[model samples]
Structure formats: C-alpha cells, structure tokens
Target: MATPPKIPGLGAFADHKSGTPRPATPRFVTAAAWFLCLAAVMQFIASVFAIMHSVSPERRAVLEAQHAAMTGNRPSLEALQNIDVITVVLSALVTAGAYALFSIFLVKGRSWARLGAGILVALTFIQLVGVSYPEGFTTLAQVVCGVLAIALCYLPESSKFFATVKSSRS
Candidate 1:
C-alpha cells in the first residue's frame, strides 16, 4: 500500500486510500473521564466521613449498645470500631483507586477499561444502599457521577472511538 503524502503544517496524516484524517478522542470520552474523576473524589470524601462518624462519641455509644445486645460484650467496642475503620479505609482505597486508574485508561480508549468502569459503577451502587446520613449523601453523589461516566463511555461517539483505538492497536 502506498503511504499518504504528509501535508505541510498539519501534524496528523490522512489515510492513504480514504484520504480522511484519523478520528480524534471524542468529547463524550473526555466527559466520561471527568465524571470518573469526580466519582473518585466523592468516594474518598465519603470514606473520610464514615471514618469520622464511626469514631465519634455518639456513634461509639450506639455501637457499644448494639455490641452489648448482640454479643453480650464478647468483643470490646474499641475492637469492633477499629475493625470497621480498617475495612472502610481499605474499601475506599480500592474503589477510588480503581476509578482513578480506569479513568486514565478510558481516556486513552482502552476497551477493557470501559467494561471495568461499568462493572465498578454497578457494584458501587449496590454497596451504597443503606449507607447512613452524611456519608449516604456523599455516596449518592459518587454513584450519580459513576453512572454518568459509564453512560458517556457507552455513547455512540465514545464507542466508535474505542473501536478505532482497538483496531489501530491490533
């Protein structure tokens, strides 16, 4: 196949046969990346709120009462609260980290990242259910952003962009 002639002053090249320039990353994909970033930030904030609430005196009292009723104080309240904080921290790191990493790859047009993002959004929504007051609001915001990001990633222009990137790589 003959190579397309390089046009002066233009950094991009046209296809030799079709004479059309390569498609640029679509706005939908860029928007999706932003939404993913927003979700990640919200997830982190929610985790912080959860940690703060869990360690508060009032919350500790409630937890202590619940623990007394449930286990007859087999495990101390401090022990249970420590475990809860650790779990929240680890979960936040994983979820937020995944969102940040996937957003970078999704912007680069990785097909797998798009699918992973969708799965993450669904899982996040399910997990956020029954979350309490302040943290619940943050989780709700995170879920909304996640849903919007996944929706944008699956839009027609974004789909075409991913397909083009996939074909070019192969």
Candidate 2:
C-alpha cells in the first residue's frame, strides 16, 4: 500500500505528548460552525417570511386586532407598518455576515471567534432562562442556538484551536 500523505505541521496522531500540531479545530468550534450555519439559514427564512407577510394588509389587520384585544392597548401596526420587512432583512444580513466571518475564523483557528461564540451562547441561554416571550418559536430557537453554540466551544476541534492560539501568543 502507498504511504499516507503527511501534513506539514502534524508529526503523528500517536505522539500526543509531542509538540506536534493537532487539528486546529476543536469539537466545540465545529459545533459552533454548524450552529452558526443553522442560524444563518433560519434567519434567511425568517427574512423571507417577514418580507412576504409585511405587505399582507389583511393579515396585519387581524394580527393588530388580536394584539389590541390581548394588550388592551393600541397596536403598533396602526401605520400599516410594513417597515418590519426592513428590520427582518437587516437582521438576516447581519446574521449571514457574522456566520461568514465566524466560519473563516473557525477555519483559520482564530481564538477570538471561540470566545465571542461563547459569549453569544451565554446570552442566548439567558433568553431561555429569562421570562418567556409571547412568541413561543422565538424562545425555542434561542434555546437551540444557545445550546449549539456552547456545544461548539466545548468540542475537541475548538479546544485545539484555542490551544494553538494560546501557544502562539505565548
């Protein structure tokens, strides 16, 4: 059989104690990458829904009436506020952009991305632990996103990335 191809920095997987390079990615980072990708896809779908629903005046009216009855207050849809479409689009764009940047950093073994992803996970967890919002799906999504983000940070690939980064700094 032919010999296995050699990676430049990696000495051998068996030599774990040596100063050989392991995979730059840890498990957590891989999870985080998947999580971010999911979030991006969800955001894109939500943006499309928002854009389509924003212009549905009939649907808006029903929602507004329901809101008025539930809250005993004037609904914000009074202006026929299709402006929410913009907000949704902007959110989708921002999330997509963040995902792209995070993916690049993940591939390059950037430690800062790991830290930032951790922080985001914490914040998302807070959303789950905090009071439930009126929207059920939003809460569910937040919990899923948070859990995945945390999982990514804890993975082996992520650990390696962080370790490499620390070693470089020192």
Candidate 3:
C-alpha cells in the first residue's frame, strides 16, 4: 500500500503509520474538551434550577391563577405541569450525557465527536430562549461554554488534529 503524502507542518501527527509516538493533544482541542465538560455540568445545574423554579410555590400560584382564569380547570393544569417537568428532566439528562460523552471522545481525537457537540450547542441555544431568570443565568453560562467549545473545535489547529487522527485511522 502506498503511504499517504505528508501534510505540510502536520508530518509529526501524520507519521503515526510509521509507529512514531502520536502527537500530544493540541491545546485548542484540550480547551474545547474542558469547555464541553463545563457545559455539561452547567446544563445539569440549569436543569435543576429550572425544575425548582417551575415547582416553586409562587410559580404554582401563578399557574393556578392562569388556569382558573382561563378554563377554571385544575386537573388539566396539574397534568400539563407534570408533563413539562418530565420533558425537561429527560431533555436535560440526554443533553448532558451527550455533552459528556462527546467531550471524552473529542479528547481522544474522534472527529465525529466535534460535529455532534456542535449540533448539541445549536440545540442548547434554541432551548435557552425565554427561560426564567434563575435558570436563565445558568443556561447562559452553559451557552457560553458550549459556544466556546464549538469554536475551539473548529479552529485550524483542531481541524488539523482531527484530520491527522482520521488519516491515521485509515
């Protein structure tokens, strides 16, 4: 089999086929991974805050008043709230899990992990709109970390690193 041509300035990373030691993870990728981990933690905290805020006495009172004013129905409103809580819990767990899993694979130089993280970041941004203040703050922090992670993962150094990993795998 013909050896692949060495990419300029990436010879060290691309030479894995020759059994030389693999290049150290790039700083950009490392930073991206840490940012992803931070995002995951922040997402979980934000979810908890959201759940607390949603079930607070004050919020319950407001919801009750709204329901009473609209349809004079309590049972339906209670059911709706329960569904909302369950949805939020499930969404939070899935999102945080994806962020954590992708971060681990990203550190190990999996090219697909970055793409998955980027998609999650986009979804997080959409989910954060119109959140209540307490949870909003945590969500905002998570968004910042997620944005930074995605940005870092697309940087030139990170791109090269992923490319090297992909080529080595082939």
State which candidate has the highest TM-score. Answer: 1
lDDT of 3 at 46: 83
Find the 10 residues in a row with the least total lDDT in model 3: 11-20
CA-lDDT, candidates in order: 0.83, 0.60, 0.82
Residue-level error in angstroms, candidate 2, position 127: 7.1
Off by over 4 Å in 1: 1-23, 66-73
**Backbone clashes under 3 angstroms, per model:** 0, 10, 0
Q: Which residue segments of model 2 deviate by more than 4 Å?
A: 1-23, 62-82, 121-146
lDDT at 15 for candidate 1?
24
- Each candidate structure's TM-score, on Cα atoms with residue i matched to residue i, is 0.78, 0.57, 0.75
For residues 1-170, what per-residue lDDT tens digits would candidate 3 score against the true structure? 99978566554223345444445789999999999999999988987887787787887888788778775445777775787689779988999999999898788788788989998988888977777675588788888999999899999998998887766665
**RMSDs, each prediction?**
9.1, 11.1, 7.6
Better of 2 and 3 by lDDT: 3
Taking all chains together, the TM-score of candidate 3 against the true structure is 0.75
Kindly list the per-residue Cα lDDT of model 1 for residues 76-160, writing each as its tens digit: 8788899889988999999999999889888777888888998998998997767777658888898899899989988888899
